[model samples]
Target chain A: MSNTLEISNLSKNYGDFQLKDVSFTLPTGYIMGLIGPNGAGKTTVIKTIMNLVMKDKGEVQLFGKDHRDFEIEAKKRIGFVYDTPNYYEHLSLKRLKNVIAPFYDRWDENIFMDLVGRFEIPLNKPLKKFSKGMAMKSSIALALSHHAEFIVMDEPTSGLDPVVRREMLDFLRNLMEDEKKSILFSSHITTDIEQVADYITFMHKGKVVFSKTKDAVREQYALVKGGNELINEATKQHFVAVRTGAYGFEGLTDDVSQTKKILSNSAIYEKATLEDIMFFNNIKTKAEG
Target chain B: MVQLILKDFRVHALLVVICLAALFAASTLYIALVLLSGNGFKTELMLYTLITILSSSAVSLLFFIQDEMFKTDAVFVSLPVSRKQLVWSKYISSIVLLLLAFTAHFFGFQLGVVINNGVGFEGAVVYEGPLLWCMLLLAVVAFKSYAFPLYFKFGMATGGMVFSVFQLLVVIAFLYSLQFETWTDQINAVVVWAEQRSLGGLFGMLLCLVVLLTSGSMPLSAQLFKNKNLGT
Candidate 1:
């Protein structure tokens, strides 16, 4: 399988908000989590890929074809789920299926029905009456039933309860077993991405701070703790960002091994989790000025 | 495309029902008033049919403006279908529904006329039918030029306001045009021609409707929706 999606130098601008030179790729057979802070342009990036919003510059290629050129057919293979369910409030599940099933060439009624049963969504109840988890489940069911090759979800598990979130994550994990399928799931929740993402892309202030495999991210960035006396200009220059206090200081560094070797008798290093990396990166980026 | 049409119908079913009921009630009341006032029922039926056709067309355009422009367009654009399919489906459905509403109202008006006046004034001049057809054609053109563009450019609120302004302009244009001596003469001649040969006038109106619907909606809808910002 090839790259399911390739977005290069994609940019869009609203008076005060701008997404500048944003680029990323999601390879087939893997899940790429787009982890970002609030207002980091994650939704804008997803919308651009779907052509829901116009691009001011750059290109998006899905399945090795330019998005604009293959929009009609390419869209058939792409399914989108937003943070909130976007169905008509008054429509029942059955009515929605009836309305949507005929639009997709690959729509499978049996698969849809099975999903409905599995999710335990009521067919007769209006979407407005559904709970948040149920609505998200229905959205997932619709997205999967179309046999889409690439699934793009913007914050699919943001507001769900622990059990429902676990269920959603488990379903996504199961989905990743198919080598032909790919997913770009965006979320601000580090734990959610940590569990299911094979690769992670960290975006901040409309720019990609980092994009790497989950293993590489965990291996490369590390948390460093040192005494107040060791937290000097020389030591600070070596680390990404130093959070200093009266007793000691802690910092994040890309080269934990090298930093430990240089500061052999000075600091202690520990493996970085996704959350630590994101926090320090944000702090480092903010402190640069 | 058919699925999109069906979905639109499902969403708009309540509004359609209310509009149909209103048309029927208004037409019947007008016919009753004409009979009670001792005015010829057939003449009044002709006017009622004309108003029904015009109002139905205008109302359908209004609904299109409301649905496409006002809310999050994600419901339509996020589907597996193309924008062209969605726009075309709305256009086709609106025209079909408007025509159905007009026909039903016309039939009800004719029935009421026959019951009240016994067809005594069946041959009275009926300018409203042809005039209504002209109005419907104008409504389609107005939708293409004003409402669809507003939807494409500004989303719902601004586009809806623009459409309302355009509708007002259209009415003003019609009233203003009536003041021109040549325009009045031509319109009077067309009305007289329509009265003399009612069947030919009806056929001409049908032809105009076909032309207007075919030429006005397809390309414009495709162009507008193709470039529209669906995220909003």
Candidate 2:
């Protein structure tokens, strides 16, 4: 399968914070989740891909061409939804369409009007008067109106209530059902990523702590819980991280089958969620290096 | 590009209306003062006309350039429009708006003068020659001092103060030049030379406007926006 995006050795540095060498690829017809904690440089990574922020060192290729070379035509095929709606405050939905429609060759007014109706966005009200949820929906509608192949969202679900978040995710999933589109979204809400992502890339402290297929992340890592005695030096070496408590201990491991073979009689294995894997991986990676 | 220009005008519609009204009112007031003074319309009327043209051009330039640099610029950059198209749209729109404002102010001044001083004042004074020179100087100054710096810095509030100071210095230099002993003779000599040359002054001014806009704004805007950190 062709890759929609290929990032290699991407790095950016602020005087105090730095994004170390990061590499990843999102294949076509897949949803890649950029999972990370706050200040993990998730937004920075997205911005660099969109060329909203300059990269210190690295290359980003979108659809087999360097991003800089693609220029306006390349940008036409990509949709970007920033965390904050940065549109002019005085413009209404209709006004915004008038401003944005003429630029894109594939802008579908019918699709835009449909989204406005479906999302219940008021067409006449100024955007500054929109509720947070309404503003987010409007942004999504705008993104969808353009016939873009690659959609990148930054913290799209942040500050949203459960119902609104679900609706937004459902809309995105439906869009992905066509199989010709790809999405790269960054979020701290692991459940949202867990629900739609085919691939997961976990970043922490400006580095990729772990990256794998969603099923692989679930299959490779297991939460082993048992008595404190079960957490021994030999077993610890096999596990990524261990949490000890008064009653028992739980740990994460990538080689779940191997760890199970060694500690067969002592620990009980449980399925790991993406969040659990990230937590343990972050702690373990920090501890080891 | 037309759509972008229309959108920009819509965004600043209120400011445009206010600018038009102010120009109309100022022109009427100046003409009334000139007529009611009872002395034959003096040559200073041309100076007043020059001041009005330059001031209006500066204000309009500031407003449009500021909006392009700071307020609506981020969205413009992210759109499918190329940076060149965006820059050209602003440049074209500013010139159009400036022309419209200048025409309205000019006619309004003429109407007021005609109403108060009768048809006799219509051909009594020759202001067109000076007015054209004033506009050319204003265009060059506006592009260099306002548009170019605003494009480079990407913030009107930050760049505007420096532009204002520079304009003040230019004005001070012009005033200082008038202190020379032969200033009046020099002015007459240049005017005579220009008249004999026929459209040389206007051509020189047009060339300066073109050079300032092409070499100053287009490249500055493209370069600054090409590598700018838009997320900021």
Candidate 3:
């Protein structure tokens, strides 16, 4: 299958932090979770893709077109949801729709109204009166109204209650039932990603730690538990990061097979979740510094 | 482009109404003062000139303030619209608002005149001529030429502060220049020359300058805004 999104050697500098040669790909018909800690350049990457924040250097392709060169055409096929929903808060949803609907060639008023009704968003009330969940639902309704083939959301689940977030995830899953659309969702909440993402791209400190299928990640990465004495200078290199307690030690390893071979059945291996991978990678980075 | 311009007007309808009302009030007060104080054509002209420039600038600045308040640049950028189109829309919207402000001031002036006539005040002098209209247009366009480039590049908050400082420096320089005999002589010579020129020639020159400044600033603002980062 062709890739829905491709980013290569993406770099941006903000003096205090920098995105260093970030690379990732999301195949068509699959949800790619861009999981990273706060301030880990996830939002910056999304903004750069949307050309909201101009990239210092690199290339981003959307549906086989250079994002910058064919911005209008590329954006026509993509729906964007900002973390804070950057809309005029003094206008009602109905008024806001008039301003936005004309810009998209394929906007469907019927679909928009349907979503609004289902989401229970008020058409007459100004958006400033909307609760956070209602505001997010409004954004989603707008994004989906134009028959967008690709959806890009930056921290859409942040600041949401668990029930609202679950509803959002369910809506996203329902959207993918078409088998022609793709989603790139960025979030610091790993469980949200774990529940919806087919592929996971993990970032730490503005760098891509890994980008792979979720099943591969689960199979290759493991949390090893054993005595503290089991970890030595030679064995430590096998672990992405190691944490020790008085009774025992647990470490995350990317190469589980090699680690198992080295430890020789001395340690028990457990499946590493996305959070575990991120946490261990962060520890490794901090230790290296 | 049209949609974006309309969006600005429709989204900020209340703010626009407030601004127009304020302009009308100011215009009425100025006209009443000109008639009651027996001010000459010169004083009336100066007061109207200030109103013309301020009205256009105030309207343009309000658009920027509203954009910043809502962080709507991000929304615009994400749409299918190009950056150049966005810039063009802003310029066009400012011109439209300039015309609207002029209309408000004109109606306000007429109301003042009617009220004065009702009170048996014959002191009111109306200067309804092509020269006045052309001068107003030049003032509005020239202020926009000065304001938009800075606003597009540095955004409203920072650009506004810089513009204020620049204006202060210009005023200080003008006052300082009056102390020198040569500068005062040159200024007087230019004014005398302008007065000596034919009305048609003066009007054509101001129109040419206005066109030149506007066209030049359009491309500069578009270029600066093209690569700008719309970060919160």
Candidate 4:
């Protein structure tokens, strides 16, 4: 299967913030969620892909075309939604859409109008008056109206209420039904990603901790908790991260079968959620190097 | 798309209107003062020229600020266009705005001259003999030399720094133009010098110089922008 987006060895430095060598791929028709804690270079990776931030060294290929060499052609096929509303607040939504329409050949006025109606955005009101949720809906509508096959969103639902966020995740889920559409969404909200993403790339401290399908991770990674008697240094090697409590200890292990064999009726094991995986992965990576 | 160029003008149309209105009111007041005072045509003319440059600069400044709000962020640059096209659209828009500023200034000056009742609706006396176009274009070109490269490099979020520098230079140029008699005498000598040489050659030289300076900077500005990050 062809990949919709491919990034290899990307790196960027902002004096204090550095994005170390990072790589990932999103196949067509799948949602790849980039999940991380705050300040883990998630936005930096997205920005570098859009060429919004210059990379110190790396290659980003969107649909097999280099992002820089064929920037215009490549961008024409991309629908980018920033975390913040990056639009003229003084202009009304329709007027702002008008300003954006002529840039894309595939821009559908009817589709945009449809989204406007669906989102119930005030047509005549200036964007400055919009609530954060309303502005995001408008941005997503604009992104979709361009007929782009791939959507690159940087924390699009960050500040939204839960109801709106659920609606957005559902909308994104429906978007991928076409089998030709794909989304690379970055977010700190793991539940949102866990609900829709086929693949997850967990990042911590400017480095990618793990990138795998959600199913593989969910089936493989486990959380095991027991008393201190169940813990030993030899068995500790199997755990990715360990946190000890006064009466008991809990640990994250990637191989559930191996953990089951090692702990053997002494501890309870449960499937790891994206949040558990991310939390433990961060701790593990930080402790190791 | 042309939309990128038009966005700034659309957002700040009110500010433009207000600035132009102020220009009209100030010029009218200056004319009233000159009519009553009755003894300082030379000094009055210099003051009028100074106002023209300042007001024109103000209009462009408003447009620049609004443009910065949209451009410095990742908003517009994420549009499906090359940076070259984006830079070119900005240059085209700035030139059109500069022309608008100069035209408004011309009208304000003519309004003063017509009211004065003896100057035949001419603001031509301010700069002297075909030099108005040359000087206006020169001032705009010089202003943009730093403006274009700085905005491109720093994404116009830092535009205020360069803009302040631009405003300072405009003030200095205005103060220097206070030696109006000396400039007029120099223009007279240059006109005679041109007439003595081939007249067409001097006109051609000025045109070529304007074209060279502007056209050359077009690519240079685009080149400066191409490698830089869009969101500063």
Docking quality tier of candidate 2? acceptable
Q: Give the CA lDDT, 0 to 100, for residue A184 in model 4.
A: 96
Query: Can you write out model 1's per-residue Cα lDDT over A142-252, one digit (the tens) per residue?
Result: 888989999999999988999999999999998878889999999999999999999999998888988889999998898888788877788777787889888888889
lDDT of 2 by residue, A138-209 (tens): 888887788889998889999898999999999989999878799999999999999999999999889997
Query: On residues B16-121, what C-alpha lDDT tens digit does candidate 4 reach at each position?
Result: 7777677776766676567557666655665676667656655665655665656543676677777777777777776666667776666665676566664532
Candidate 3's C-alpha runs over 4 A off are: B37-45, B118-126, B129-131, B166-215
**Which candidate should be chosen as best, given DockQ against the real structure?**
3
Instruction: Kindly list the per-residue Cα lDDT of model 3 for residues B120-157, writing each as its tens digit.
Output: 23222323323444455555667566778898988888
The model with the greatest lDDT is 3
* Greater-DockQ candidate between 1 and 3: 3
Flag the better candidate by lDDT, 2 or 3. 3
Cα deviation of A28, candidate 1, in Å: 0.8
lDDT of 4 by residue, A1-289 (tens): 9998899999988889888999989999999999999999998898888888889998999998888887888888889987756557777888877767887999998989998888888888988888888999988888889898999999988999998898889989988888988899999999999999999998888988878899887888999989988888888899998888898998899878988898899998887788887788777877888
Model 4 vs. true fold: TM: 0.90
Task: Kindly give the stretch of ten consecutive residues in candidate 2 chain B with the minimal lDDT sum.
Answer: B119-128
Clashing pairs in 1: B69-B156
Query: How close to the true structure is residue B187 of candidate 2, measured as C-alpha lDDT?
Result: 50
Worst 10 residues of 4 chain A by lDDT: A82-91
Q: What does the interface RMSD come to for each candidate?
A: 2.4, 2.2, 1.4, 2.2
Q: After TM-score superposition, what is the CA distance of residue A6 in candidate 3 from its true location, in Å?
A: 0.9
Model 1, residue A19: C-alpha shift (Å): 1.4
